[model samples]
Target: MSDVNATSVRAIATKDFRDAVRSWTFWGLSLLFFLLVGLAAFAIGYFGNADTSTADFLGTVSQVTRLVVPLIALLLGWKSIAGERESGSIKVLLSLPHSRIDVVLGKYLGRATVLSLSLLIGFVIGAVVVAVMLSPPAIADYAGFIAMTILYGIAYLGIAIALSSITKSTTIAGAAMFGVFVLFYVVWNLLNFALQILMNQGYFSGVEVTQTMNGNEMQYERLPDWGLFVQTIDPGVAYANALSVIDAVEAPGFGTAFSAELFPSGVPFYLQNWFSFLILLVWIVVPTAIAIARFDRVDL
Candidate 1:
């Protein structure tokens, strides 16, 4: 394989980005995000009391995006390389002066840019609506929320693009996309539940801690720090925790009494919300790195 050429990467990225922007996929995502945010703002304004703040609005939107962004990314990226290969269009792509590394990097950037732009367009529209509906909008919190959401989307895009490059068939790529979805959305959540059950069954030891609630002392078993760390390793969980750290929103159920009991001294650096930012970064980097390495050696 040839060494990475910045000029080649840039040219490929530009071409891919232009092509993606022209597609309905880009506009559909933009519309989807806009509707999701607009509805969230409307619900907050219509149903919430005057005390409902912009942080609350952002929190709600973040939850929605956590589920929606990965799906958008997967759909957008599932066929990036696999579709090209299946249709034999990859020959034209490689006929250019680009290397495989350039193609992989370019594809990842192009698809990620599509998702990012759609997010921006939607958030801008949503911001305007939110500003009018919610007084004293937490612009800082909203900005932080948007930033973290983009990172989260990029992480999934990276995953999707990597998977796309590994296979020659779009059908297999589509299945891989579904597997990615299930791995994160369903299986990851189940792991935490299963761990708790094991601990309850005495299969895994848990830390016992006591706390006073409304002047009544209560004792409960909390997951060990390692277990808590495992729970936060999910990209979606990391995204929420990162938001709490950046926006100071005190994400619901995070760092609560139960959490404090799990870490009496203090949350370890790895398990802290700030560390989740690192976890998100790792998610964005690792999968793509592996894909790039493997794609370079594969028979195209």
Candidate 2:
């Protein structure tokens, strides 16, 4: 087994990026993002009153992005290493003095760059159009939202790539991607609901907090801090919660809103809005780390 070589990693990354850039998937994603932002702008400018700003536009678009970005990242990564291995191109790739670790790192860098560039193109154009349409707020916040969105997208991409690296079967990799989609969007939500049911049934404990909504005090049994941590396990939830931390969003939302109301006695460290970023970072790291370790030890 060869050690990771910087030059080899760079070569592989550049080649991978060049190859991907020429594909329809790359252009299609870029066009999709451009259209996503354009549509978001149209929605706000057409139906909204004076209160609408770029932040509102971002929040609206982010809702769609949460669903779209992960799917796109998964699709883009579905064939990354698995297809190459299936076709025996992994042999040819390794013959070029690139270590397996380099291959994983390089592929990740290449694809991550592709997604980031595609997002930048769309957001740049959208920002220009947004300036013409809405009462634009500070560009700093909008940039922060774009940055966070990019990080969110990268986290999903890393997960997909990690899955891609583990198996030689593209079919299995594709199935894994779908499974991931189901786990996060469906099962993750179900887990939260199930916890709520348990809390209501007194099977699980939660802090009863009184929140003033509609100027009326309403008592609610909120999830315990640990249960709340479980909800933030989803990348989308982390993205939204982190968005609130940077003031990129107006509301702290993702099923549960983070407010003093939810934690009258002060919020726990793990449930803090800023902690969501750490959660996202962990997702990005842990998956790839698993892939590299497992992939390296496995027979090609």
Candidate 3:
């Protein structure tokens, strides 16, 4: 790109970033994330007890991020583009000589930077709590979690931008973005439930057997194993991958596995997690591409 174009793009991005940061919403959200991190750490460390291992402490931290960070990202990003359009500034901004690609990418980067800072602060607070309670976390673990959070934040930003690009009102865009989160977060569980119910209905069972025991004697039992596949298809499985990365410090205890373990197989090596990660990437890239395309053709 020419220096002039580069300068224009940067100028646009800088103005957006400044406007975003200056808004009360940004600081409020950042403070909320900060408080959440501190509270999550306190809850985990206090309830987890002083004897909780570093691994467990960090695992709790990861859980907090997985469940909480996305909401913060959504709040930060849901209106990035749509808000501009609502205020009638989008046309003026797009009138610049820079391509829509530059505008879209630069806006994404600027908002993402703000989100990264908030997430970083929250994570650091959690880490401090972990260190005070147990051994410090490994640098590798911190690096991996940070990378994952960034990728996830980027994914949310893409979704928000797409929603904004298509809608003319910020209120509508915000609603749509929240709708997306609700669909992803809740619909996945409902799908899993339906799959599990179907599997348990015995449609796949080719044979049925009952086990009876006399004294210490036991008899063999047989049933269809197709239920496992249904479990794998559940979108909640992605959350399991996030958990695995967070829990990488050590495998959960057998006791932990016997009851309510997240990802019993631990990040499913046979392409399930890999597939979900790819889907998430697509979710990020496709909307972003569309937003860029629309911006290019838009009258603004």
Candidate 4:
């Protein structure tokens, strides 16, 4: 592999972004997001309390985006590298001064940027609809939510791009994307249920705790700290739970309802809501880094 030149990476990223923006895929996704957010805003305005805060509105939107953003990002990246390889364009791309690292990194950045732009624009339009139906929402809080949602999409893009880089067939890349969706959305939830069952059956340890809720002493059994960590491993869970970390959303117990009341002593560092950000950052970095290294040594 050649040395990674920032200029080459930027040029490739620019080309990829232009290519994608011109395609139906980009505009189609934009329309989908526009409708999605517009609908969510309409629901809040039409059904929610007269004084619902921006945090409340965004908290609800986060639930939908948690799933939708990953799907869109995965689809965006599923063909990015594999389609190029299959069509023999990768050879032409690499024939330039760009390194394998440049291609992978550039592709990821370009796709991520496309997704970010689509999200920002969609949310802006959605926000207008929100203002019309309800009172104006908090701008800072909404911007922070948008930032988190963009990061969430980028994290999934890293995964899809990494998988695409390892294959020459778009079919395999697509299967990998579906597998990721299953792994996080299905298997992860089942795993949580399994953990709960094991804990209930005394096969796995459960943490016994007491807290005051509604002015009454309450007792509950929670999965152990490690088990709790397992739940946060899902990017969707991390994204929703991590919303509490930002100042824009001031709602209490926002971290998947895992609040200070849940822990009688103190929340473990790994269980802290802010840890979701670290997990997300890892998802973005680890996949791309490994893919770049492997792609560098692979035969194109």
Q: State TM-scores per candidate.
A: 0.94, 0.94, 0.74, 0.93
Q: Give the lDDT of residue 299 in candidate 2.
A: 88
**RMSD to the hidden true structure, all candidates:** 1.8, 1.9, 5.9, 2.1
Give per-residue CA lDDT, model 3, range 30-56, as digits (tens).
676567656756676777765666555
lDDT score for residue 55 of model 2: 72
What are the clash counts of all predictions, listed in order? 0, 0, 0, 0
Instruction: For residues 1-300, write the lDDT of model 4, one tens digit per residue.
Output: 567789988998999999989998778887887888788788888898867777777877777787799999999999999998999999999888888898998998899989999998888888888788776778878888999999999999999999999988999999999999999999999999999999999997798888788889988898888898999988887887778778556444457666687776778888888889999999999999989988998887
Pairwise TM-score winner, candidates 2 and 3: 2
TM-score of 3: 0.74
Q: 91-198, model 2: which lDDT tens digit per residue?
A: 999887788999998999889888989888888887776777776647899889889989999999999999999988999999999999999999999999999999
1 against 2, candidate with superior TM-score: 1
- Look at candidate 1 and tell me the lDDT of residue 299: 81
Worst 10 residues of 2 by lDDT: 249-258
Worst 10 residues of 3 by lDDT: 253-262
Return whichever of 1 and 4 wins on TM-score: 1
Colliding residue pairs in candidate 2: none
